[model samples]
Target: MRKVGVLVSGRGSNLQAIMDRIADGYLPLEIAVVISDKSDAYALERAQKAGIKAAAIERKACASKDDFEAKINAALTDAGCELVVLAGFMRILSANFVNKWHHKIINIHPALLPSFPGLHGQGQAVAYGVKFSGCTVHFVDEGTDSGPIILQKVVPVMDDDTEDTLADRILVQEHIAMPEALKLWAEDKLVINGRKVKVLA
Candidate 1:
C-alpha cells in the first residue's frame, strides 16, 4: 500500500470519508500522517482517533511561508508519505512547494473547474445560474484548481437552489470522488498526460 499524508483546515468531513473507506478495506492506501495549518482544526482529533500520527503546523507560527512548508515537507518525508491529499486545506501552497511535490499531490474542488477556480465554487455556480455543477478531483499544480482532472461527479442545479443547498449536494459528490481518485492512485491506475488524466480499467 502507498502511504499518503493528508492536509486539512476544517471539520475533516472528507477525511472521515476516506478513513471509513480504509477501515472497510476498500482503499489500499495508508494514511501516514495528517497535518493541519490551524491548531484548532477538528481534523487533528479525527486523525488521532484513528491511531494515525497527527500534527499542527500552523502557518502563523512560522516566520515565512517557506518555513511553514519546509516543516510540512519534513513531516511528510519523515513519515514516508508518497502522496499528499488536500482535503479542505485552505492554504495556497507556494510554487516551490508545488514543484517539490509535483504531481504527487491531489485535491478535491467543489465545482467542474475551468469555470469557478478559487474559493466558493458552489456559490459561483449557483450565482451564474448554471444548469449543472459538480465536484472534481484533480492533480495539484502551480495554478489554483487548474490541474489535470482525475474524476468528476455531476449534480444538476435546481431553479430554486441557493448556494448553501447547492453546496450541500456537491459535497456529497466530493466525498465520493475524492476517495475514488485516491483509490485509483493507490492502484496505479491513473495516468497523467499534459492536461488530462486517464484512468485504466
Candidate 2:
C-alpha cells in the first residue's frame, strides 16, 4: 500500500473522514503517520485512537522556521511517506519545505480558490454576497492556494447563511472532495497540465 503523511492543527474532521475512507477500502493508501504543530489538537488524539503513529512538533519550540521545517520534513521522510496531506494544518510551510514535496503535497482549501484564498473563506463568501460557494482540493505550491486544481465540489450559499452555517455546509463537501482527490491520486488519474489537473479514465 502507498504510505502517506498527514498534517493537522485543528479538530481533524477531515482527517477522520479520510481515515474512515481508508478503513472502508475506498481509499487505496495507508496513513503512515499524523503530525501536528499543536499537541492538544484532537486530530492527534484521533490518530492515536486509530493505532497510527502520532507526532507533536510544536512551532514555538523550534529556534527558527527552517529548523521547524527540517524537523517536520525529517519526520515524514523517515516515516517513508510518499504523499503529504494537509488536513487543516495551520502553519504556512516555507518554500524550501514546499519545494521538497512539490506536487507530492495536497491541501484542502475552503473556497473555490482564486477568491478568498486564505483564512475565513466562509466569512468572505458571506460578506461578498455570493450566491454559491464551495471547496477546492489542489496540489500545494509555493504560492498560497494558487496551485493546480484537482477537484471541487460546490454548495449553494443560502440567503440566511451565517459564517458557521456556510462553513458546516462547505465542510461536508470538503470531506467528500479530499478523499475523492486522494482516490484519484492512488489511481494515478491526476495529470497536471499548466494550471489545470485532468482526471484520467
Candidate 3:
C-alpha cells in the first residue's frame, strides 16, 4: 500500500473524509502523517485519533517560506510518505518545493479549477454566476491551480445559493474526488502530459 501525507490549515473535514475511507478499507492507501501550518488546526486532532503521526510546522517559526516547506518536506519524507495531499493547506508553495514533489503532490480546489484558481473560490463562482460549479483534484505545479487536472465532479449552483451553501455542496464532491484521485495515483493509472491528465483504463 502507498503511504500518504496530508497537509491542512483548518478543521480538515476533507482530511476526516480520507481517514474514514481508510478505516473502512475503501482506499488502498495509508495515512502516514498529517502536518498543519496552524498549531490550533483540528486536523492534528483527527490524525492523532487515527494513530497517525501529526505535527504543526508554523510558518512563523521558520525564517522563510523555503525554510517552512523544507521542514514540511522533511516531516513527510521521514514518515515514508509517497503521496502528499493538500486538504485545506492555506499557503502557496514555492516553485522549488513544487518541483521537488512534482506530480507526487495533489490538491482539491473548491471551484472547478481554471475558473476560480485561488482563495475564495466559492465566492468567485457565485460572483461569476456560473450555473454549474464544483470541485477539482489536480496535481500541484508551480502556478496556482494550473496543474494537470485528474478529476472533477460538477454540482449545480442554485439561483439562491450563498457562498457558504455553494461551498458546502462543493466540499462533498471534494471528499469523493480527492480519494478517487489518490487511488488512481497509487495504482499508477494517471498519466500527465503537457497540461492534461489521462487516466489509463
> Candidates' lDDT values, in order?
0.95, 0.95, 0.93
Name model 2 segments beyond 4 Å from true.
none
Off by over 4 Å in 1: none
**Each candidate structure's count of clashing pairs:** 0, 0, 0
Candidate 3 per-residue lDDT over residues 76-111, each given as its tens digit: 999999988999999999999989897889999998
| TM-score, structure 1 vs. true | 0.99
Candidate 1 per-residue lDDT, tens place, 30-112, comes to: 99999999989999999999999999999889999999999999999999999999999999999999999999999999999
* lDDT head-to-head 2 vs 3, winner: 2
Better-scoring candidate (TM-score), 1 or 3: 1
Model 3 residue 60 lDDT?
A: 97
**What TM-score, to 2 decimals, does candidate 3 have?**
0.98
TM-score for each model: 0.99, 0.99, 0.98
Q: RMSD to native for every prediction? A: 0.6, 0.6, 0.8
- For model 2, the run of ten residues with the poorest summed lDDT: 110-119
Candidate 2: Cα lDDT at 127: 96
lDDT order, best first, reads 1, 2, 3
